[model samples]
Target: MPCRKERDERRSYGGGNQAQQYYQQSQGAGGQKPPPQAPPPQNGAGMEGKFDDVKPKFNDVIFALLFLAQLGAFIAISVISLRALPASEGSVGLGQSGGTATTLNASTAWLLAIISGTALVLSILLLVLVRLFTKIILELCLLLAVAMSIGYAVYMWVERYWSGAIIFTIFAVISILAYPGMRRRIPFSKALLLFVIRVAKFHPSVYVIALIGTTLTAAYSAYWAISVVAIYQKWSPNAEGASTSGGTPSSGAVIGLMVFAVFNLYYTTQFLTNLFLTTEAGIFGAFYYGGRDAKKVAWGAFKRASTYSFGSIAFGSLLVALLDLLRAFFQILQSYESGQGDIIGAAVACVAQCCVGCIAWAVEYLNRYAYIEISLYGKAYIPAAKDTWNLLRDRGITALINDCLVGNIWTFGSYAVGGLSSLFAFVTVKASNPSYIQGNSGLVACITFYAFAIGFFICHSLGYAGLSSGVSTVFVALAHDPEVLAERDPQLFETIRRTYPHVLNPV
Candidate 1:
């Protein structure tokens, strides 16, 4: 770790000045990369050696058991609901079927399959592009964000929407003015991204895991959709003529089943997402500390994530899942209140929705670092969360700025892929003229939305998650033991020091 004295000096100076002074100091009189030098080894096990010393044990066993029970319940519900799906002909549309299939049918199923396939391909391509052209891609994403703000401002002006125009104009100006400072961070960001890419490439299991995650999420999404459709077909009040059974439609039962399905959907997705992130974090942590074979490290990480630490992942995931479920519920309430012209009720619901969403975001952010701790140290969720919170508080500014910059790259990339997928969905539906989508602009819109969402989800899972895990693991590892990097890979440390001198100093 860099000396506390230097860190105090950095704190003494202001923002950009701190970075600037550190830059000059790093350059020295010769104005070149710092000479490679390893930090002195600490007592006890070396960072890499700890992996062998620590014996893995199951953490948060109760949460793991609960998660399994939930999974079992969801599976049972899905099976029962699916068995109740009405036999279908060509007819498929929303609302009352009146003796026809109203819920999703074979055509919708095919469409989902196609959309999933497209998303998978696009996500893989996105990873390839980021790896091959990290800097260029990053630059383009930044430029595009600024350009879109300017363009939107211009359009708003043309349409005589003064408020819209002014707001966008201000945003455009601020982004443009801030470009220089943002641009300066790109080199370091690019280096970090490239390192992560190289790590993923070195251990191909990372990609394999990503592939499995993408496929499972997409398939599960389809299954969830089918389950919802089946529930509506069998239990909805409007389904009287759609099914052969003459049982009266029970609205209460329908709502209960729907809620259960929705909750499980959120939980399952969150669980899988955290699982993959935890696995990747382990791989990156191993690479950072060195001394372990890449293959062994990767396999070991996956095993730990899927077994011993599974409950920790599940526990963290449950927090986010519950928040999301509440957010969704509030959103639905807001919509209902708005439709009923209950202005105050709608406003309250909207506010509640926003609050829940923000909380979910915060929890998810904490989970990112907590999972890193779990992956590296085999700690339970509470301990991992506590340590992660402490680390963030101590070194958050650097991590925040770095995350914001890199996040923009992936966010824009995912949006681009999603937009393309939506376009593909639109064109495909139009060309095929599916009975459900034909003549129904609403259905068309819904399908396109699903495509966009699935594309974004898949891209985030396969590309962003892997890379982001690498970045988070690096930060966590550095915070815990900077000496490890300095000892194992002095050259990389020097490169990091060149771009961000503050990194050398303890935060």
Candidate 2:
């Protein structure tokens, strides 16, 4: 009913009043003013732009193709090899002689088969029964043994034929590809190629070592074969008074030696390959997971392993030397009783003991240190001091020592018993034949003591290395907590876990 301009004014005033009322209501609800209205979202142009820059850098298709090609090639080769081997050859075969023949001795084959089969079945059946610690221990031991054996073989091969293009090629390729950050400047493919070429150049040196190791191993194998034959000849009714015909070994003996040589070669080659691969893989894994900064950790682990192995060898050699010296002293005393031979036998015995001791100690030390370093750091070096030290202190040194004491009491105790038993045997043998005391008795006693020492060395070195490596590997695995340590030490976390349970759990 109002005039047109007055009506417009009234409408404006009414709109203002309505807005005021709404605001008042909102404030009354919680003493807060209404929030400002948000602007409508724009198109995701920023996200798209960022992705555009990244897309060209990665060729997912190429990566997938390469991975598939490698996998396929491996599968194809494995299948072809498996098929090529005759079923009989793959399995065990009876020799021409009445005695059974197998890839391993009959006893060994049966024992391994039974043990492996039982373990597999039990693992499935009693999956919940076995402790995690136990499983880890078993896996670790197996892994260490395998790795050591592989490393030894590879080292021997590399030492022999390292100068060759093929050897250098493999080594270089592995070093580049398996080591991370190394491929950033050079494409992975090119780096691998360069590595191969470098390794090839070292084949001559590698071949020399391999040749020497093979020859020595072959001689040892021959000795082992001859010893078996001698024992058989002594024990077998059919072999009575049967000396090696015309100074030529029997066909069976020759075959035995050949088998030993073949086994030694295969084991040595496989071990060396494993060692090289494992070292490279450890570094690669660490670098990949820990980014550019983990190179030191990888190198540390490698060096530590090398150091431990060398140390063990050195220690074993020293012990052997000491025993040899004692043998020499006894030999001299014996020669004096005989009044025939001079000091030559004593001197020879001392020199032989020293040489053997040195070799054994060196090998033992190397084996031990290698096992420890690998088990503790998952490589050789750990950058995170707290993490590394904690792991070593808690799991490696502490847990391993505890486990060793518990696990190896039997091993050490058995050796002690054996030594005492041997002493008793020597005394009994001497008592039975008082005549043995006249001239060569001292020499015989020295020989017996040396034999005991050798046996003890073998048992302890092999046993402890196997046990400690296995246990430490498991503890490292169990201690891995990605949420806690992964951001800083992801490589350590991942690799420490992947060392295969069999290596740790030797049981």
Candidate 3:
């Protein structure tokens, strides 16, 4: 927490003196400031046409190298696993097809690709729709979330889960009560969302980047899935005589390989997702800070994200990936314990998993804001994260409203996209009735579930990477320099002021 004076200084946002004070305060102990950067736009200035050269220095290069090394190791393992697959190209129980057990094969991989591709298209389409009907989607998602919360609370209470029931009931009640106050912020949220959309319309590369990310994610998902299957086939203890060396892979070795492989998958996927988001944030941050050249800024940001700031993005991704790995581990432990009927052990694992999951969520949430700073200033991850923490504290109300209202829009929008994609996959698979899964309702359902999971994550990465980056950039920019918005676009400033009158000051 800040001292009272610091807090007061942060809260008082209007006027040149206050702004200067806040800026100076941000410089901290040594009074050092960020490098000279883009100038604010003039009133009514458009964000189109040529862009200028703006280069940034490399930050957190070590982490970028580490990520590359990790990728190399994973690739080596994948290659080995692929080679081993031919020896044990057999299948265990998956599902029955034509009265025989279905097996993993090239056809299975192709089907997975098709399903994931369907999700890719559906995710992109739904993202567009969400941009168009932001308010409606937001409202509907909120209603659904609230209803689910209440229903879950009731179920938990009936099941005699006192802690879960109490927690969820509180969440439900608070949501219901907060809705009235939150409702007023909807217009402001909509306006901000539209502003980002308008900027994206000017820069089509925004969507292009998202497309690249979604494609890479989908492709990687297929590759990882196949690699996992190959590992299991080659290394399973049951594959005694099938191994190329005529020796079975020990159970411990199999587990180790799988664990590392899964960790690499999580880490690589996370790095790609954050890379997309940081790049998007760089573009938006450049625009927000009044870079005259939209094209140059967009490309420049992209270059920096993939080069100079790559390590910082990797560093952030590593943290989240590690947490995710831990959470997964705990979940597995919980499942094992529950299956063993060790109630106390299962509860402990459950709590640990929940704690780790929450921490992971918080880290990722912080990274969203931190990436704005990183994208704009090229600061290393630690400093960027610290700056974001202060920004949240100083602008708590705006952050809250943005998270509660605007954030939920992208989140629930992704869910909607995933659901649609899952339906599309189910219908397509049923209609085609492919040989690998013919007459296998269980197999079809399994495919549908994978589709939903992949669709949800890919949509989240793609959708959130672009629009949500815009939102966070806007928030950070406004907090850093509202005067720019006020001077450059007085009309927008006043419109925001109407709903968030204290935006000029502090809410």
Candidate 4:
């Protein structure tokens, strides 16, 4: 009985061991591997694994060759433009009939040559620079080249030659093609190119708008030119005769004037369009802000923008009017010296007319500014009527009257300065050319040009000022108002608080 019991115990132990072995095999078959153990460290060696391998797909040499090829193309086009000039006139002799003669002095030719050369060198440099810096400088340079070429073409047209036209066309084509190359060098250029392309392709209406604006601008310029010419003819018949001494207005002078006129028209249209667009853009910006509960900010920005714009226009209009009076004075002097009595008297009359016109214009500008301010700030004062009643009654309206009176003094002072300046110019021209006032007509034209240019420049600068003020005001207002900030963008609010805390809390 003891032996049999021992055998049973042995059988049970063997069976238990067999069951454990089966369980291990089953675990392996079911993919239940043991947790991975780290590899053992090598004996005093840093690493045993292989280093990462990389393969070269492109050669640096090929890239260098491509860059050189592109640079060569740009340089070649620039060289062509620089060497070419407007064709020489077929007719010779000063003041002897036929086509207007072109007298290209050494200085003028040298300047043109230099411009062309610089454009070429810069274009090539820009190509390389673009590869490195990836900015729009190259594109801007190209645009400048195009503008220069256009100017050269106009010069040719005035000379009645085809050489300039042909050269301009060729350069224009090159610029267009090079634009794509420019895009490839810069990411933003590519994006801008795509945007313009998309606009051309999808929004043909934009072209129509541009065409309409251009047409209107041209018509306005034509009307202005005709009016000026008619006035000149009516005032100074002798000056007209002098202009025809060379059998036509000097082609160069005429071309120069036309170019000046065209540029003036373009700038004027651009100015008006910008003013309109700014207001629209501001309104849109404000509306967007208001939608986010930023109405006060928008209104503030609008007020500032309107004030600056109106102020600039008022100042420019006054300045131009003053300059015009000076110009008229010079014209009368020129006419008198040229032995043109009818023209002298006529020029004097025109000066008188201009003075009247300027006064009206000044009043209009002031009224416009006043209207805008009143509409924006709300009206609370009357001038003459209120003063008479207040003076008669001896009421406490004195402070209010004083404020209104003081507010307009500076504006009236500006008008007074303008008038005085005009008077000075008129007297100066009359004094200088007492014998032949007609001879000073040329001086008048020159002064007029200067005045127009100055006014435009001032107006342009003011537009920029307006834009900057508007942007700053909007950003500042956005920085404040925690609720608005939170609703618009919590992240942006935090960023503003972190980066520009002082801007938000200005002392």
Candidate 5:
């Protein structure tokens, strides 16, 4: 427990400086910080286009080499998995028709299964070790996750609709180049030494983050799978639709499965994502503001996560879930369109996919940073989200995110790495199968991808979430009281500058 003197000091962090002035004002009215807008829009204004206060440093390379490893893992895995996928009706699972299962020799089937199963096990163990022991290795894995996520996004974009891809590609370029206060990109290997220092200094918080995120992910995934399966059987008149045998399934069965699958994934993912993310932030908050006792800090994080941020976390999760459902629904439509020739489905799918490029990225970005503030102040969701956005804008964190892709990069890598790793298993299975099952490889690959992806994602979240929160906490702490960071951990305070040159003294 912190001594009385420390408690008195922490109280001061709540207020008593220029930084807290805005923070104080934000908390009053749902934490809304109105951008400086001139009243007359016709002549002079709307929202501020650029950050007025923040000046961020460029050339941040916190996890560059790690990102490359992630990229290679994803690419190699994806290429190998591609061979497991048969060129014919094997594509039917998500969009295509269900035909014959791919024939694979017993040995081949065993090989693929063993390969994927091993990858899954190793990935989990690797993530755990990275979190608890090897900080650099953990980051490398995290960056791999980010690379995968980005790859998946790209694949989704160009896979179904070329036109959509072309148009969005233009928008993406414009968004990147035109965004104000943007900085130059860093080397893929930038800032390893600096990031290593940061990680070492805060590994205790990282450990708690890893454990909490992993537990929540496992719990949610199990709950989602069991409930979704039961719901599938409940809605389907015949339970045989549960089996992927060559039998035809009613559209209703597929729809039931799809609806539940989409919503529940989003629901569970959002909830766990928020819950763990908030915990990650709180853990960092305890350490950055108060000195660390891993268990006590973790407990404090738990209280705030369950009690204070409960409402916001639930509601915010719903929004992300719905948005994801929208994205997934479009993909499903596109899948069925080729064979069904449902022009209406095609049209609607096209419309649905129009915003695919931006919406997912934006929603993800908001959920992540918003949770940090939500955990920090014990504020409600909307206020916390608004305050977080305002703080990012005011502090140049948004620019850092947009230009640097510092925090969210690992998520993309994790998604891709899992897919690629699944692919690796898929190829190995095909080579081992004497009969060479055609379609089954894709199914196995998909399983491997999801299993590895989900677990790896949660693991990477441990690293990424804490690090991002650390940045946010430091920014807020500095703003509220510049000396707080310097006084509490002067080494960390200086290290922050090396990591982000744009940071200004709050005083």
Candidate 6:
């Protein structure tokens, strides 16, 4: 491991500074080519030997059991919530007592039922339909659009979606298949997933780190929940007869605004906390797996994430929080009836959602690249973000990330896991506690489901962040330091060079 002084020296010559100087000298003012020289060793010549001495130090079998226990703890609350929901055949009207589940609308429900009934057969039909198309404009474009419309219609029926609100997420899976850049990412996505699982499987401590972040975020959330109640009480001191609006906005409206502010603060805090936590995981994975100062990776990640790069963490997190806040307000609008202003509300909804998408894309793009650079290179947030963008743009990796959809894949995949786990939770309660799920179970189920979902989401977010960040880090590291890439894993280096020649090889 590099000593403190040596580490400082490494930072002085690392990341954007080195990248700029190297690119300038090698590529000239035109900057038309990658540097011919292999990147110097990350922490000087003797560091690799020190890294070698730092063995993995994890007992696979023992750590596997420990990891299981850690993950089980995270899911236990979710399961208990599911088991407590009103799932009985006629538990005081399933619709009314089932809590706030995202059930299908009447038309959507019927459509989903029909499609779900033929799920096994639909695969074959869809595959045949896809194979039948031979023309680019006809098959991939026209025919695919028709097929996607059908699928989207089904989703809209059940999910209550607005058109064009989220082009990235709504048609994300299909987009990956249809778009050429994303289509190329099919293989890299698998490779990235495998690499992430290997990291989790071997270095079980990663789970502990994830759990810690999730726990702290939950704690702060609980504290905020309590604070919200106090805020509401102050707004309506005379709770029983406070419905009157005293020549101003109703107390509920004020409370809602306050709650939105609290939510923004909460989300900002959550991401910053998570950025540090998952950045720790990214750092550990990068060094331990990348064959660098493995033993000191944890400490190094902390000094870099918590100290030097805190500003980046805050700024990126704020963008994420802004999106969350906007989405929450949008949901509020959707809930309230729009009456004569329906057209105005619809227009506002479209604009609000567009803003949400822009912020979401920015945060996603920044964090995916910037966090990796921050961990590996120890650059400040803005500098890291800017330089990273230039690197990806110059290498055409920017287009790849957009079309490839790996980031969205991981995100939606995590949500799927959370949904399934929540479903299991609902089922468990319905099966085991038939009597409790009867009359007056609405509030109980609602509270239980809310807690369950919150816990499930936090746990899932923490667990998934490392994997997502790891994938980006691996690719960025591969591009930034080919020498380390080739030395650490020649097989992976060859795979990158072969699979993404546009990204790995200089023009």
| Candidate 6: segments with Cα more than 4 A from true spot | 1-186, 197-203, 237-257, 281-293, 334-341, 399-409, 420-456, 505-507
In candidate 1, the residue pairs with backbone N, CA or C atoms under 3 Å apart (3 or more residues apart, or in different chains) clash, namely none
Q: Give the root-mean-square deviation of each candidate in angstroms.
A: 8.8, 26.2, 8.5, 30.4, 14.4, 14.1
Q: How close is candidate 4 to the true structure, as a TM-score?
A: 0.27
Model number with the top lDDT: 1
What order do you get sorting by TM-score, best first?
1, 3, 5, 6, 4, 2
What's each prediction's TM-score? 0.80, 0.26, 0.76, 0.27, 0.59, 0.56
Model 3, residue 225: distance off in Å is 1.1
lDDT of 2 by residue, 1-507 (tens): 335763343233221222222222323322344334311122322122221221111112332343335335433432332232232232232222233232222222222223222222222222122122332333333333334334434643654533333543564455435334322322222222222222223222222222233333333333333333343332222333233232332557444443443333233322332233223323322322232323233343334323432232222223333444444445455555447555676566556556666665454334333333332333322222234355454434333333332233223322443343334435544554323233554444443453344333323322232222333333333333222223333343334324322222211
Name the better of 4 and 6 by lDDT. Answer: 6
Put down candidate 6 lDDT per residue, 379-402, tens digits, no spaces: 555666786777787666664455
The deviation in Å at residue 55 for candidate 2 is 28
Q: Could you tell me the TM-score of candidate 2? A: 0.26
Q: How large an RMSD does model 5 have? A: 14.4
2 or 3: which has the higher TM-score?
3
Question: Top TM-score: which candidate number?
Answer: 1
Ranking by lDDT: 1, 3, 5, 6, 4, 2
lDDT for 287 (candidate 3): 55
Q: How many steric clashes does model 2 contain?
A: 87
Cα miss at 403, model 3 (Å)? 5.7
Candidate 1 deviant stretches above 4 angstroms? 1-41, 44-53, 93-103, 144-181, 240-249, 291-295, 397-404, 432-440, 488-492, 495-507
Cα lDDT, all candidates:
0.70, 0.33, 0.68, 0.33, 0.48, 0.45
Q: Which stretches of candidate 3 lie over 4 Å from their true place?
A: 1-55, 84-108, 131-184, 239-242, 245-248, 291-293, 397-404, 422-449, 495-507
For candidate 1, lDDT tens digit of each residue in 195-219?
7777777777777877787778877
Candidate 4, residue 38: how far the Cα is off, in Å: 62
Native RMSD of candidate 4 (Å) = 30.4
